[model samples]
Target: MAGGVAAAVLGAIGGAGAYAYAGEVPRGTSVLGVDIGGKNRSDAIAALHAGLAKQAGKLGNPVAVRLGDRAAEVTPADIDLGVDVEATVTVAIEASPNPIGRLLGSRTVEPVVTLDEGKLHDLLGTALGKDARAMKQPSITFSGTTPKPNYPQPGRGLDAARSADAVRSGWLGGGPVDVPIVEIHPATTKEDVDKLVAEFARPAVSAPVTVTTERGDVTVAPAAIAKSLRLVADKAGRIEPALDAKKLRAALSTPLGAVEVQPKDARVAIVSGKPRVTEGTEGRQVDVTALATDLLAVLPKSDERTVTGKLVAAKPATTAADVAKLGIKERVSTFTTKFTGGLGAPRSQNIVQIAKDVDGTLVKPGAVFSLNGHTGERGYRQGYRDAPVILDGKLVPGVGGGTSQFTTTLFNAAYYAGLEDVHHKPHSYYFDRYPAVIESTIFWPDLDMKFRNNTEYGVVIDTSWTDNSITVSMYSTKVWDSVSTEYSPRRNITSPKVIKLPKGPTCIATNGIPGFTQDAFRVFKKDGKVVEREKFTWTYSAEPRFTCG
Candidate 1:
């Protein structure tokens, strides 16, 4: 009985000792490189904050996150990736539960981290904006004569949740945190593109398709089909076929001309040196869009491809009312430039041809007229003959040489009509025949003269030519009562250089002209008062004298 009593007392004493030891922290305990052994809960927390202050400060700043080769910085406060000091100490205290184990061994506790997924996600989006790549879907475009396909490509984006967790665990280490990147796949795969090409794009251009309209049947060739057909990806990246109705109409215009009643646009025709408006007429037009849709339905078929189209009444693009609204009734300005070439001369013929092409052109209000845009290449095919043209400071026989004479006349007419000059370049050498510092030259598409009709009324251009001169007149509502020019005295005059060349078909003799700088001021008058004055300046290069041996 005495031994039993002694055993009970010893057990009670041991239990009391365990209760005292558990009140304080375990010995040899460390948390985030901070030692807090044999201390209470409050003391352990204090030690953790004091010991981790420097490391926590480093983490509080910006932490660099690397996404492949691209890197961005993230502030701990911005993303909510940080440690909970009180919670960390509690975890360290609970790490060693057994009384004997806590007394005998050392424990290293991980810092408790706090991370808000919403904040982290937004922060990552801003930080890694450039590094994030978007996926591209497959598509086929009809930009060229044939269809060209753009293949699908994969993209990359950050794995936000995983990266945030990584930062929470690894940020305390004070180095660049590696972000996880995931591949983003496009909805339209490469296999889908291959299928589209084989199923539609390739077969659509394999043969010609005939479309029958109310007028007659028009055949669409394979090249035309290739130009009109387009394989595009929709919003969901699904490949679909489409047709360009405008291009299809252009291809079938010639064949359908015989069967269709075409509408005539309103135009101005010069009569007795006066403006006459010709009324437009409406006609039955083919429904090209519906016709193209029917053609697209049978483009993939190899045999018996034909469809019927409907005809509808269509109005002219420009009506008689449109022309009447322009208020073009009387002549506003006229200019004439005389040439030395007589009748049947190549230069005279060129001047007449260009004048005919530009005759009766109606320039709308606020519209710009381009000489080169109207008359493209003036090669032999365009009926321009070989004429003596100025080249390399000498006279050489070139096609469309004297067309510049027409351009100069048009420029002067536009100038006197109070039209705005968009672009014009004077001749390389001074020519007594042309008004000094006011004339312009043309060299195919490069050297062009352009003018804009800036008035509220449309301008009608009329051209008339004689054997030795060409005249251009503009008919519109006159803005100014009269327009005159004031010239500046010629300055910086230089003598011409005499050039000697062997006698051949290519060389022509010429008396060289002197170079000089001059300026002209356009005076616009309204009610006998000068309303506005615009200045124009130019420098002319001396034409070298070419002597034939």
Candidate 2:
């Protein structure tokens, strides 16, 4: 009975095979929603193309793409986005190549779409606007003059491969699909910045800078300038070196300032109608500005760091005997300056330091005395703190911030005293505490506030200060009968730019102020006649402050 049943099944299969061999297509065979059943090969091919004519006209009916309301339409034809009809037809045709398989089983062919991936890739690339930054993989770049890694910035774009796969999958699975075009994004990270900082920047501050001279070598430890060395972004938004000029100048202050000597000029005075002659002396001074320039050359070295520079001489053109015959008498000029004190602690410390250095300083006949030479270095160990210092025309925290206030005091005192002008630099910005157009700024071992004693007699410096007030008094016998001052209103006044930063852990806030330029003059009178006159100009910088979260 079992054998008979098997024979009946075999006969049924054979009959089905015979029927399939004689037939073209059974009844229902469709592809891409096009029915090709019971049709010949040529008819099926024609039907395939006709059914997909609408899909080929994808430009007219584009697939709607949306990324969080950022809508974009993509033409499938433009991207060569279409089904592989021939391959799909081959798959359909091959499904029932044998008679038994054709009659006994039914098969459905999902078209295998073929597209010009390069063109698709290009289409995806153009999907974004020029303003839309493409996602970038993390990479190292030596785009700068120096050899170092640049930190990466975040960006966004459509994911090419995954998006293509999704398009094909949707078409094959369901006809109605509003593709949720997934967005690919670059890492929103500063990890690269952190990495470079760890790998290079932090290690750079590990060793002290060895500045070698023929006489000896001086070391500026990392601790001194490390805080000043910042990983600042360049114009291209790459991390670069930000060596604080103020900090570097302050750090090199002592060693270099020690090498300088204030020149002595011959002193001559009239006493009992006899001219007394004081000897002239030679002197040496360090070229600290040049040293600052050379710092970049030697700082990033494994070994051998030495720099040599020219020293400026304070040479007296005339001897004391030569000037003695001129017959100049006492009390030429004198002036006083007052300051509002009750200062901040950092400023107070700097003021006290400067006042101590300036007091008891003597300016002799035909001689020059520099405030910097007298004060030497303003070092942290020497009572200076990381207060706000002016740098690159901006006031920021540095080692000797408030010292400039003293510069104003001494400079104005010398100016009103009818002293000879030498060299003085004014602040970049105006401060209410300082007298406008009549102020000074100093960077030790480089810039200085100097005045020459053109008078025959010597002038003495006296200083007194409280928390709320301070005074600078220059005492000398009157060479000019009186000294008076004139001034011009600020010209070329400009306002500062305000910068805003997003609210974050790195947010910082600073208030900005305006800038201007002005001039002041001192007139000296002897017997009510003008004997000498001097002029001083100040160019204040516009300080741009930051506004933050």
Candidate 3:
């Protein structure tokens, strides 16, 4: 027919240029619709890698596209479509029923991607920096410590900014920090043990050491230890070795001694068992070692001793050759005269004619006698001073008013010789011709009379007088054998008043005579039994009869 119809139009233009060099997609091209028409480029790149691996499995990753200015990693093996690349494209569209009218004529395509944008920004910065490091959050620190500060533990801490930055970064650990140390710990309380025992106690000061000793002698009384430490004496507190001068020279040579006075020598004729009278005088032999060297030159010498002496003995003297050496025998008396009743007459010489003129002798055995050596002062020219005188009661001009009745008849012959009355006085009133207890009296220096030969046997007194008879006789060694008297016939009698005279011769009657009362007794014997019996009483008043003009 016209050359067979022009070879059928050149094989149909060589099959449409082999479907555009094999990257085909024309028969009802609906790629994801299961219709890749002539499907060349390796089956249209295997259907565009199964349609982008189903859109990259629903876009789970790898997919950036925009080619031209570069940006392409379309994974799924880079959508080869069998590699005809060159900005690949193939199309022959159909299927328009609104699938976007079949993808709008479909064929506008390119995909030969290969990209590494710095490894995709290092895999998206290492997968978004590993998901921003797994969304992090953790932090919290701080450290400081010091500990153990002994004693009262004075290392304070309350976390002072973490112990001052742990003492400037010197580190310690365990976070919640707080440290500071130094330890000791002991003093509990009582003011912290009195400030730790006042920093270790000890204060009783004042010491001057020096205490030498092998044991013994220690006198530390420095003012009693300075008044027991209250201090003073220059704050005293230090004595030693100053006062034992050999124990103060043995305590001043031992003191404490005195009290002495011994004397002995009393032999009044063996206490008067007597009969004495020995005459032997002659004694004058003193030289007693030159009087003990002149009394040791007036005593005192032991280094001129301060006080302490000895030399006793001095008491002895009673001579008349010590009473004729005690052998006994001496008597002499015989001078008599009589004439009672005349001599200025006053009722014919009364007072019993002056108790018959003085007569004396009687004192023996260990005797020491003297009454001016036995009476002998009767002067008035030896005529008895103005004779009859009793003055204040009548008769005047007195001289010794009847010489105390011649000492009351020689004290009744020395109390009938048994004497020992060493001193006597009686007559402040009552006076019955004297004899009231063997009366005796005188007043020359205010009355006096004494006796003492207390019979150990020795007495002799024979004296006689006459102006009207007076006699006194006594001789002993007969120590009483018989002597008698007994009288008790007077009772409570008082009368004789009249004493009113401020200056007038008022009721002047100076005791002349009136009241009277009596009682008397005396009996002494030895070999005849009845050894002693003595008693006497005489009370008389009523003698007030005065008249003075």
Candidate 4:
């Protein structure tokens, strides 16, 4: 009994010692593979820090997550990957809570790893978001000259929540962890896309098409079809093929214009002292929509390779019947202006050319005729050459210089024809070649001799020129018995300024002329009775005569 008493006392003493020691972790206890056995709180936490540092090293190197050829890297340190050191120490303490239990079993305390998923998302976004587009299901494309199609792509997307969970779950475990990426499926599947492609896009681009009309033929080669066709997705997620009309029309515009006959307005002229009109002919035009439809239809089966669609006839803007309704019966009024036959032969040739240009123009009632418009741009193109023209009160060599002779002649004819003068500019200086105040001068673009045909009948102008002379006559039904011009004597005359020229053969000698202001009355008489009388006034500037030094 005494021995048993002694053994019980010894056991009690040993139990107290063990209880004091068991406050610390038991042997073989580790935090993420780092042994923390027999360590104090501070020492165990330091050991956990070392273990986390090792894990960080393993995760720092790039492990790329790839989709097709695209890849993004995940860095553990960038994501704030770390261990919960305090919590890990608490777990170690809990493992050894009871002295008896601590001595009985081995324990391993796993350190909780921490990370910022927002950081991960940011890093990945920059790396991966560049080429991530919503899938265009069953997209049609061209491979060389042939039409090629692709199946619907189940696109890839980043799932931050799932990725964060995975990274957390796998942190303790060692090895490479693949990033979790969500697959974004298209609205249509591969089978549906394939069927639609086969039905529309594939067949449309499979063969060449030819368009034919009575006028000509146009071939739409396979290469053109690839550029012209498009595939679009509908609300129901169906892929449908359609021709890009804008692109197709642009492609065919040049070819269509080449084969088509452009429309022309009817031309009017006086024949045999009466108004004569030439009938306008209809021209061929391609129907764009019809051609597209026919080509789409015949491309699949027709062996002729020839799409048959007749060209539509287009009507002209003016026809022969339109011109005949104008009442251009007889001479309305007539006048002839005479010029000296041997002065400025160059000017005479220009007068003849201008006459021919204005001859066929028909002036409708109340319509104004532009001398510059009828004469067009004058140069070598219209067969005009350099001649004498008055510029800054001096004669200078210029193109279309002699056209003023025709202008005066035409103006007088229209003047007696009872036409209203809309615009006219007289010469700056008085010259024997043109009548003062009543004559008109012409330049291109800015200045013109315009007159409105006020009478109900259309007027046909007739002009002809001889060597060193020009005469313009108006031919129309007689609106007045007679028309005559009365002129005022030259007044306000200024002495001509003399200009000395440098030694040159190109210099021209001119006679000094005085500038004057004059007035004229154009009187229209019907059966010996006074009718309309219009007064015209002019102010001329003195011109300096040039003398070669």
Candidate 3 Cα deviation (angstroms), residue 175: 99
Q: Which one wins by lDDT: 2 or 3?
A: 2
Tell me the lDDT of model 1 at 204: 81
The window of 10 residues in a row where model 2 has the poorest summed lDDT is 138-147
Of models 1 and 2, which has the larger lDDT?
A: 1
lDDT for every model? 0.84, 0.64, 0.39, 0.72
Q: Which prediction has the highest lDDT against the true structure?
A: 1
- Rank the candidate models, highest TM-score first: 1, 4, 2, 3
Candidate 1 segments exceeding 4 Å error: 1-128, 141-148, 157-183, 250-262, 283-285, 309-314
Query: How well is each residue in 416-493 modelled by candidate 2, as lDDT tens digits?
Result: 777777888777777777777767888877889988988776676666677766567676666656777788887888
lDDT of 3 by residue, 1-549 (tens): 988889999987677655443434553454334445446556755666666566654433344432123233333233221223323433232212333333233443333333333333333223222222221111111111111111222221122233233322321121221223222222232353333223211111122111122222123222222222211111111111112233322322212111222232222221132334332233322222332233222222212212122223434343445434433342211112233554444322433333333222335575744343455454455344534433343334455555555555656566555465566655545555555445655644456666676655445555544446455555454456555567676666566665443434223335445565666667787776886777656555455544343
lDDT of 1 by residue, 415-456 (tens): 999999999999998888889988999998789999999999
lDDT of 4 by residue, 208-316 (tens): 7777777677767776777777665663346655667677767777677767887776655656655567788898877766676666665555365567755788788
Q: TM-score winner among the candidates?
A: 1
RMSD of 2: 22.5
Off by over 4 Å in 3: 1-379, 383-395, 416-475, 481-494, 497-514, 527-541, 545-547
What is the Å distance of residue 85 in model 1 from its true position? Answer: 39
Give all TM-scores, in the order shown.
0.70, 0.39, 0.23, 0.48
What range of 10 consecutive residues in model 1 has the weakest lDDT sum?
15-24
